[model samples]
Target: MRSGQTGDEAAVDVSGGSRRGREMPLEVQHIRDALRREFTSRISMADYEGRAGTDFDNAFLSRALAARAARILTDCSSDEAAAGVIDGRDDFGIDAVAFSASGSELWLIQAKWSDRGQAGFNTAAAHKLIHGLKKLDNRDFDQFNVRLQSLADRVRGVLGLPTCKVFLIVAVVGEGRLSEETEAILKEAAIDFGGWGRTVEHRVLNQAAFHRAVREDLAPEPITIVATMSEGWHSRETPYQAFDGLVCVEELANWYADHGERLYDRNVRRSLGLTGVNQTLVESLTDDPQGFWYRHNGITVQCNTIEQEFFAQRGPSKPVRLTLHNASVVNGAQTVTSAYRAYERTPDALGEAFVTVRIISVNGTPEGFAKEITKATNTQNHMERRDFIAIDETQSLIREDFRLTLDKEYVFKRGEIDPAPASGCSVREAATALACAYPDPILAVRVNGSTEALWEEGPGGAYTRLFGKQPNACQIWRTVLLMRAVRDALHDVRSTLSGRSASIAESGALLIAHIVFQLVGTDGIEEIDSEWESGLNEVPALVEGVLAQLIPLMDHFFGEGSYVTSTFANEQRCQQLVTGVLQALAEGTNVRDLTTFQSDIPKPRRRPSTVSLIIDHNLIPAGTRLEYQPSPTEEQAIGIWLRNGQGRSFATWVDDRRRPLLWEADGQRYSPSGLVTQIWRKADWREAWSAVQGPKQWYVPGEGSLVEIAERLWQRIITEEWSRERETTKDADS
Candidate 1:
């Protein structure tokens, strides 16, 4: 239900005036009527009048629209929706605020109710929204109205969640379109707020969508399903009834096609469209339909009642017909959706597929019984795609081979702890290494995008190609060693780099590993030799050389402004970059001549302090765990002291920039640099360095150091400012 388009229209005049000659459009009139009927009693008339002065009608309409948006998007009751409305003076362009039931998603709505149905979201509105978003992100609640202030704690809580998402809902009672210029303005806001991950997105609800929401609200329909279950039997409990049996895949597909998302209205979330796991399900159905019953977890349906059709003198083994009333698929939504997709793609293949089904009837049960069933079904830990691979014969053989041949632990199970670095390697590490070592670069790219692809089975899948024939123990161990070496080298190089270069170093680690594997010549890689192990010594230099060549080649081919993360993940781009890098190496391109690639060049000295930059950009989110990565000298000096205490080397990052690191060692907060000094003093190390660079010594595990992250942010800001200046100059010239 999300789209983007362009329209150019002047902003609506909302000043107090009589509509003597204006005729409201029917769509707007219908929406106005619906809102008046639903929210007249719920809204505060006095507050609206006080805020709007003489423009009460427009204010009321705006509030009503906000309420409707809240109800539609958050699935809240009318009372809650009305309470969410904060549309008035000092509202900061955000009309309403609502959070999902789970409190993991926040929706901030900006509504424009145009009687003439010509509302337009222009650059001015987009800027105002961005300003409000920035204020909220900074936790400046006092600038907002009383209603917004009242929910400050909740808002702050949602914002602090790492996985939380903020959706800016622009609800305009006109055509659902935005000017390209306005769209770019909003996109800039998204980029500013998103940082390394997409935390913000915007959605527009126009005239047609507004009407649809109103109609759907007035008369909501309950979905009913008719399914035949083989060997079905019912357990007649005191308050509820339960039925367990097998259902055909075709029936599930039909149910989904008929009811669509309505079948999962009561579920926590709708089907996650075509995720890797779901894609595998479709593959299973189309490729091996006969084995679907054995491979799949099937579906669960909860209903108000179930009516069974009587069969005269039929045996217990006969199929039973049942009509479910007000049915909702509480679990296995992905399975149902994937089955439908498979059926759509290859209908003939699904005839042999049967799925296990469990039906629960809430008739005469407790009020929250259905919800309890849903919560229980979804809360339990289910098997992931990787879990299936644990039982693979090849993996089992690899495990045995590691234990006997290499004398190392090769853990493959989901809950088993991964072996420490250099001690051994897990299946995940092995797969990534093997993918990087493979002749084809696509495997490396696919694994980089998602490791789920590594476990994908069947023809032309990574799993089939990598482990089709049980790989030798020596090959797996050796490749894993080389990959680990590449990662270590990249980690060191990333510490001194910033911006896109740092990102390329981190995200492109696998591609770099693949290129290094090629350069090292994998002739003796299959055999454990002194020469192969000695070649590991050459990896750091190889990594530097590869990066010097790779960075410029990537820039020359895929413009300097190209997103490093996307380019590294792209198969074609990775292939081309690899080819270009190999060509450059073959031609002996002197990277030292390139000033940007020279290792001896000193970085700019006049940069903002890491703490100030991190605070300004919110680079490291609150409550992020940071680990103390002691330098070799620090390790030698205070390693024993850190190990003496259980949590001495760990700290939690708070929002306070000046004193962000809350040290676990002493339950005290200190600045990053201060913390490092404190650790040195506490360890009583006589050889402690006088000047400590704390940001470089602390890390976010998989991510880089705080200084590296701050540098990236600084570089990003400079790049954006430079781009804006260039655009401005170009426009002036035109």
Candidate 2:
């Protein structure tokens, strides 16, 4: 074998010349230079420092290649990439491992670096990787080096999740076809682990891909779009050029496939990712393609230059071809992504769909014109399903009734600030509260799944059932208060719980609230100063009592190992759980101890620092975006501040626990609580509370809050400990 070359690396020669005689490709050289510059200090020196000259360089390059793969594929920062590297003597053919921020995928990277850009992934390498995968499957972390062992807990945790996929990334510095034997090895491994779901997959990152990633890292290439728009019209103004037309859904999907999120770099935000609004966009494209253009607000593109290649006569049927240079979608990013997803699902269905397009070229305009256009387009308040409810006559009547009868504000407008806790409630709160209070528990389930269902107007919809009859102001207010009380009580109860129970507390709050409402009885709820006030007062104690019975009942009906989120979201399961709990309550049956549901010993009176716990356990992957959900009081005070284009409601989570949240608004890092306090101060809200539990206020969108994530991790640790203890006991018995 050549010096510094492994057996597998020596076997394949994609390039013609010998390793020492061949000259390095300029792209490969560039990649090498960039990697050394970025990762020399970042990669652990202890791993490769023992070697000299070519050997040292080659080993370091191999580790650097793995880090690069992590950064490029996982979209993680350099720090995370370096931390992910586990390349060493006992690496088990895996150089690095990284998790997607969403926790949906775990990437296992194997890298090969060659000076002449002739790195190869041969049958030997494939077999080694497959053998490593089998060891991982058997939970044999001890076989790997200390670096891999350090991540064993996190790896086990991720692998245990049914939803998380394992991706084997084969990264080589050369471009060549994998041998049939090598391909077979990977395919057989994937099949062995795949079972019912595609649990394992592989991707090859060749030299060309590496080059693209390197170039993108240095400076992103500007996105250029070639669009053929029908019914196109141009603005006659001099300072800037603008075009208005209709673009086919197919074209938008193609752009998304090619450019992805690069198309939204200049936008205020990236695609919101399957939000309720975006889901509706997807539904429209798939279900009613022809009507999508009429129902949807079209996309706006900002470009450096626009050239009309072909223009037909001034008829609606004629198509005009335009080439847009350095283009970015400033608005309707959600629409574009949604279209892409919808197209992916049902490509044939979207042929009839078209979206209106507005393209603007600020090439000759003022310095800030492009920015101004981006700002203006995004600043305008867009309509949601709830916004349409604000226009309803019944909602107006409720607003008037609150003013005339209760002397309180009942804000129904989408952008309007929610009233203070003591004063009144918004339509959203009222809807959710009323949903829980409704006779059928499925409405509450729908609300828990997505609040959008509350505005869905139809015979069977929650909106019609709750608001179709124009519920009285007193009923709305009382139920809203009751729901608030249930939530507050549940939040306290949730803090004491861990594992699936904690998840149940978070996801099944509405269900629990609905159950509490049922037990309290809904008679005289509409009457002022009625017995319902006493029931509302009993809520805190009632919530605890109900949950004590309800949680145990859920485990009995649904298996103890069942996913709490899916259980609560499923209408049938929730209905069954509610029935079982209510029946037990009515019969005065003895309930299981709440301790049976507890996954860990009681937490200390002084809560551990969230940042420390998160970093210690590696519960959240780096570069995850956490969303800010203001406390009820803070929401009332800073609604305008949050909405004022300040980017106040989002923060990127870094690995640093002391200052985990990198605030997007000011480009500064702060502790979760510290950031909340800062926002309060910046908003000039004098009434801000002295104490803030920041983890409770920030969430990872689809995932739970920081507190919840930490609790789950703790629960997993305790469960694993118990399982080990049980195994030991079984062995002793044997």
Candidate 3:
């Protein structure tokens, strides 16, 4: 057994190797070097695999490295000498432990290793480590900070002890690629954990550090990538395909743009007869001609910009009349006539000057084509610039509405940050309202004496508690949500009255009210009266904003729906609703105020289309009435015609029944027998809602009984329809 080895370490190692022996010093140094190499190698490979995989494995590598270090410490020191043992509980900061001479100092080492790229060590990784140490939810800044400060206090509580010393050793196994802000945080942590004015050393062992360890034979395994071929391999030709998990420059270029300029030029040149015209010079001119260049088949030829430029620069040199009568290319070369004029030669003097040249065209030159493709693709990154788009008026209002809704309903949740700023116009108003709204804390007293109440525990005690259902958390949460909605609507109304645009103001207020209704029960309005009064000054402004902008825009967006239906009663009902809403707005009261007056009863009732038919008539035959029944879909038309004249069947009744219908004396019954005879007479009403109630006959004009009943029934059906639709939508979402 090793001299410094613990009992467990000794049991693990069969061969005895004592640290107190002469070779102990050399052996310890060798092992440290080996560890350094392993760390460096992990970093390099991890980086190349890319961020996602690299990030995942980096965490895994950190744990593995810590385990390795613990094993090494066990080999170097006895159980008594090892100051800190790894606790399998929720210990996040301390990974491995080391001891000093006094046995007082506790060295806590945390390792961070990544085989991914350097850029992989981002803010998320930093936040993750910190969150773990603080026992807080990740990505939540407020929670993380609160927990972190609490942990710091706990650590500070124990610092006064003489035997206590916490040394945080952050072992980074690669280039430290943490953002500047994150790096500063780690540095600050080190300073605090090690104690002020204490010696705290930091080391960065990179590639060189690993190489030294490997050369000295201190590692357990050698770093190498050994390539081995399969048992039986045969190939004809493997077509071009991308390398797995890798995107080469050529592949990216081809993906973006299929055309390759270099290859195109080569093909064009070979088509024109210029085979033996100095291959290098021809290739150079084809790529980037100095001024102008020409292509010639056996008899036909065409000159481009390069040739034009050259002739222009050199004055009027000879008009080189080169012609190709015929041309063909075999194998690698082409045969055809080609001609060129000297810089000083005149066109007439150089008549008939022509020569035949052979040119070879290469098809499969991947290396050259790939290089060109890379150069072209790389240009895109530099050429492109980002531009910020401004929000349009409609979109801007939408964004504002969305923001209002989110703020009104988004809860910080239990055991998390609260959504309040200490100072502001809204804060003061909200604070006062909240204080009165919840005068006493809502408590969940249990039968047991335990004060701690877990969300999982319900109101029921241990006996039937096993089977008793728990109430929804959303129910308890809705009260507070309603308060938020009321406050937000008030704020928007106030903003609008203070000169904000009409649409903007109304949308903002409406959004707050909508969110509140969605989050909480919308049945009671009296309870929310105090909240409405507080936000009253802003209501009219929001209404005006809507009337001025939103209504006009809606009319334009949905052109056909702007026209009102011809029915007088329908128009009158709509006018009443609109007038009621606008009256509150005119008085500087928003939707919140109206809710108080109206009891917040949601409009638009839901109902089934089919209703059972009930027939009862004094003088009319029941069979005739049953035969004269109208379809459910024709209810609206029947209702409209009934409003105009008593006992007269609507046009739909004539079309559907193919005959006229007669009404009984009570006016509720329809009889088919009297249609052909015209003997059916209109019946007097029983006057159920008359001023004089001794079986008085009804008068149609200026009567409240019949009109009121019709209006009430219409409202009831509409409300039923709306509620049904709302419930259906809610179910689907859940």
Candidate 4:
């Protein structure tokens, strides 16, 4: 209805006839009814305006409408009053304010009733309400007592505190009119504004822009309104023609939280996936009757496809649009009524409406149970049926052997399946009987087939007689063949993994094979181990042989003979292998414990003495002299000479260029407590053999005297020859 038009201008006669001389009054009443109806229908939300008016008139008109809405709300005389106000200095834009009867409770609302307005209005309103509510919460944020009169001031404030209850409400009166979509929003707001174990009374007034007409009205009652001059939304379920107001933040938060489930249900119903809770009637019909039904967020008006489509095309003509389709049985009765106006009472109050449906029970044997049910009404009755009726009171009662079904003239919806025939036997029982008699013949496979004739005839003759009712032989055979192949393949994989041929040597392949075996072992397996090996003794044997070869090879090159040969050779080696094998183990265990090696050395009574030695000698007495000193810095020059001289100190040599005494010296020395082994010094060399050879070998050679060894040694002879040339030049010069 226009802002200037009276309620009479807004309605049209829904009833076909017009009363004599009552046209004007009727139109006025209809307009009033229409205005109320339209206002109520859209009370849940605000309408969408894609663009804002850029001109001053548009802006002025907007403000005017908002002011008018505020006036209407304030005039409502509800427990609360609401209005919209725009603060020029604020960036938050328009807000709505609601005041309770005593002006103690304040509800602040921020509205974005257009696409370009904002999605954060609800969030912003919630924040404001949360802040305001917290103020009323009597909490002290400054617990540190930083202020001079902190404790004292608080004590005084508490003592002087007045008895007052103020709740902050925030809500988003969404664009696009009040609708079921706002159901979730309302629930969320209720929870939030309801405050600290208490409930907040709230309502959302979703209205259209000034130029737009009220969409529709469907609320059960008029909502309490609070008017205030703040830029925000309104809370009245009734639409105030000029009001574009705000809702409380507490309202927004509560509505969001509570209605999330319903929104989720709606989205699930909108999709066609086989999964999800079957909450929607549409989904339930299309899905297998025995299959699970998915649930939707909310119960949409229980409707069939045709009625829903019709409403979609015509727009909402009533608060609820429900079409009662004839009669159907639920439990065991035929008391379903054809009266379709029952839903006019309320959306959530359908349970109170009386509905009659026929209920039928088909328990095997000839006799069955039939019932006429009239629930939500005075009369209800049931009785046994001696004979089944083809048409039972404009409804059909079809008794299939073991089951009974009741349905009025079948109305085929988009995804409805064909119903089972009205056979004398139940579908399952009939199928089972046919399968038994028609073991080979196709004609005998049908429900009403002749078993005797099929036995006399062949597959071709039986199939010819059966025609459309006969089972397709090709399809059956193919299905059976495929199943057998899959089963066999699964078994083969199982056999492979359990086979003795499963070797860890091919670790990657073996691991994959083992995984395959597990996947196919649904029925479980027997004789888990392969016949190839009863025990894993060979594995250890092979590992030992390989380790034996590697140990000696490593020892020879590194000059450490007992690296690791026998499995029990050393605890260190065993530990190394164990650590390698179980490296993936968590860091908590001690790695050294896995070793087999045990130390043979006794605990020290006293630390052993370690000694260093030097040997000084001359190869050619008085002509060319060779000397060895343990001058680590100078030892490189005389290392070989010291060793060959049978010099005991030379044993310390490791290499001629590095440490040459390791090959030659040996001795014993007495410390304060005991005798300790040491290398011989330069003083211990035997000078008697000085003239016997050119130079002594650093290492002990398998030979007797000096010259005897020189003839067998090429390196010694080369050294002697070089020394002679140098001496001749020195003597000639002298």
Candidate 5:
């Protein structure tokens, strides 16, 4: 459809009529229908170009082959918009056109509908394609119909840009493997296209390859797996055949080059990026090509039926030879892709590289079976850190339950699109927070480092160890907020701590989450207190305040020396740091004046409330004082006061550090409390015996030694409480 004439001239359709022998494949026909349904020509090109908002014919210029070509563009390319169908008598050699969203890349496609039979591409098909590409190359769409004219105008700006990229694709429904001569011709044509101030990439896709691309997009139709079999090939009672043989690396690479990531469609975790595992595979394939077949696991393919072409044309070591076609690798994606990448990087590395293969052909099973195999095979890959938490039922429940209950989308799977404003947290984030917030400090530290172990349900399962009770969606959401707060705080503190790298090592999250857990008492409900919400909402300030104290404490503790382990998840170090902070808080010995640990020695300041005074004095029995009330958090140490016979009081608190002589005065300077036994020994005989009897006793003034004095004070208070209750009963009776 090329001529020197302008837009007024009619086009010469180079594409002959469709080969009229056979009907289109059912799959291909379905695709054509889908394309026409999804996007049809809304109006005549002349009317559309004229900008007349007229009624559309809808199917005015629908072309099945052109529709398929447009569909390929929509499916495979990024930033692509459907060009729809534009076939006409004067459409030149081009069948379809699509423009990149940014108008920087232009795709021109030529499609041949060979409905009659499977025909290999020859020089004639290649020449027609080359002619169409030349029309684009010469900017010679003069003979083009109104549709191409309209498309050309839409991309007129980018087309002239020196860096513009152009792609010319030739798609066919038959076995049109390009002759070597055709490939060379296209390559030379690509060079010529590049000379015209633009870069060009050429592609040719046959029916089988096209189907692979489409199926990979979602759940694809099962493909036919052609297998070469020896006399040993056998069929069991099942509706499938089994065969074993050598599969060549070259063959694998060819498959990858043809179908690409589609081969790995069943993998739960697709192309792990440039991860160390992927890199290791890549390295092995590149450095040890011949041995790669031995080192790597061969591919697992899914197919509808298995057919064999066996021969006695033995290749040296192998006694017989066979060829397989129409197969899709259901597993061993990393091995195949890495091998492909390796081959691309170093072609010479491969010398007769071949792998032993096992082919299982499914006859009656549905496509679901193949997908299940994919998922099962992929799940067996060496577990990554995320895979552990990714499926934790707690996390899954949170996401699923949240979505159902709150009417919001929650994404726990990787590659899942994040909702706006991040309506959900990653399972990893929730698990990490739960681990840190767990009641025990020992497990919290481990949770930070070993995410993979968290989901284990066996003995000492990390999931059970950290979180035995099921968590609610609301709690998970709150945990997400806490993590965000902690993350923000790390970012802020990083700037203040100069010459120190600003990054908070992932191991540090446990300590930070622990800090938050300590600050905000666990309410057990999913929602946090307003104060915590405020602090977290303030970004990292609350976290920054805690870090401000911790960084210094860490510096002082590790001064001129270092920890044996660099990771913050080092249990001993984490325990020491967290315990130290809690102790500092109990003694009122920190900065920033937080409501709880703001100062160096929190004082009730005012006289004890009248109710407390009654409990402390008149209500107590003659020689005993009141019992102490323990804090709800078994982990946090509550302040307690004890008085001896002299009426002089001593203060103490308990926490992970377990201070014996916790703090005496303002807590500015402190000393170790030694041991629980030593504190008990200070009390009188009766008081010491009492102390030995119950560890919860913290205050009971006037019992000789400090411990007894504390115990006596608590006893008096307990007595007052009992008297108050009796008085209230008397009033009720009156």
Candidate 6:
């Protein structure tokens, strides 16, 4: 190993001046030169990529490796290929996270790229990479990726999963090799994956290993099928040998589990769900395990080349065994799926069963013919359209602009970065932000999480619809910035509210922020990002002040939300709020000062959603008790204890008369039994809430219940009646 390992602390000067004074590796130096070439000219990522394969630096190779990782893990298609490189200063020791496709594998990468000899994978770099992963899950860093929050979320998602796997991968180019000390660190660190139920693996690839793996689509190995299938087995010759036989179920299961979707690389669809035909194949295996081959169609696996071996046990009772090499399943995917499932569901039964297998070589077949073979095998299965973002050039261009101009990364594509950021705007983020900023809140309200509508080539596709025509690079960048700023501000504000109020605020956070932005009207996009040439916007104060103005109103209209289908999360409800705010603003009403909350509002019932779902009321309920309680001197606090399980749902409200309504937003209003129902039915005299057998309890901020308040009212009414009677008696005596 030619790695430049150091025993003593490698001196990293405060000024980036190396005390060892060693000449830079030619790889790093060449990379620096390539970067310098860019500094002399304004280049987009597209232009850079167009030239990178030829004249670019070793950093380009690092980027390519990252992209390859994305493609492999995310199963990303070629046209919309994406990856991000944190290669500059303050990278905190990670070249990139080899993004995971799902909530399973996480590959953390430490890359060393050079043009000539090895770039050293020494102890210091190893320590940095290890330290980075340890803290990255918690996101305790200053110079982190712009998509840090979303990435943190992605990591948390995987960590929370039942069984997560983490891999520490080192990709080296040029002279550097993994030194013993560095490898030891990786080996030990690979045991831990930040939480319970995770398995970790570590790998270090030298220069030759990295290039070879890339060239051969991951270190080509001999994939030979060895089996004993003598029942009606034969071979014939087409352009390629067509071998038909009965293969075992256990073998297919093992193959599927080990290779996953990779085994069907050329197939149109891999492992389609339990379709009718697929179920039929599985049913046949379960019902008639003895004659399964005669009943079901066999699988078709194609390969570039195949070499077969045959052997016998050299006994009178023994049968011959055959095996084929270098194979990939391309057709009859559904049939393969059935075989794999049968093995998983009932291996005992499947072992007695046999499935037909057709192995064919496609070495001289045209690419079109191969695809046709794959498509023809599954004409009944409907194919879902791939997301248009895969073909979207605008997203790529915006990502390029963000990289070239913002000096921060924007992951337009999935798996572009490991642990997708919980915050940075994807095309969805961009669309929602643009729509929210579009002087119209309808689109934002309607298409928030609808990936198909939001990213496709229609009304919701703000990227294709608005880009180049209305939005420029500066606007797109600023929209992302402001949206993130608003989210951060909301997170800070969440600290102020009760755990319940905070939850409601969060559900409605996006809409509320859009409202605030609308309130703080922009003159133009230029005004929003005028300082794009310099630093960040003064977002904390701007966004927080707007949130402060909005939360109080939300508190009032939002009620014991525990049961309410989130108005904040619901589109119609969001539209309702948006319209209400717009109407209030139009009416010259001060939305921030709209509601006045008073304590001692009496025992309150849950507020029903009458009309206004955007008021700013307090969450105080009224106290229960009548005879013992003294005459009400002042408004105390509503103390109805909300018993709903969902922590987020609840709010305060008032009727048109300006009296504080005790109920959560329409809480208990919809039950078939209520005072209104009794009144409508003209039922017999009973307690005011005798009909409500199981009403959810709510919390009174300062103390109480609607029953107590009603008691107080009844007492007042009785006392007034007696006083009138006494006055009449006195008048009669006179």
User: By TM-score, who's the top model here?
Assistant: 2
Off by over 4 Å in 2: 1-36, 39-210, 232-240, 307-317, 363-366, 403-407, 537-542, 549-561, 587-590, 599-734
Residues 307-344 of candidate 4 have per-residue lDDT tens digits of: 22232333322222222221112221101110111121
Residues forming the 10-long window of minimal summed lDDT in candidate 6? 626-635
Task: Give the candidate number with the greatest lDDT.
Answer: 2
Please list the C-alpha lDDT of all candidates, in the order they appear.
0.77, 0.77, 0.29, 0.25, 0.51, 0.49
Alpha-carbon shift of residue 341 in model 5 (angstroms):
22
- Tens-digit lDDT track of model 1 for 474-581: 889999989989988888886666444555666678889999999987787667554677889999988988888877776789676554554665677789999988
Per-candidate TM-scores read 0.57, 0.63, 0.18, 0.17, 0.31, 0.36
When 2 and 4 are scored with TM-score, the better candidate is 2
- Arranged by TM-score with the best first, the candidates are 2, 1, 6, 5, 3, 4
Worst 10 residues of 3 by lDDT: 382-391
Total clashes for model 5? 34
The window of 10 residues in a row where model 5 has the poorest summed lDDT is: 52-61
lDDT of 1: 0.77
- As a TM-score, model 3 comes out at 0.18
Q: What is the lDDT of residue 460 in candidate 4?
A: 53
Clashing pairs in 1: 499-712
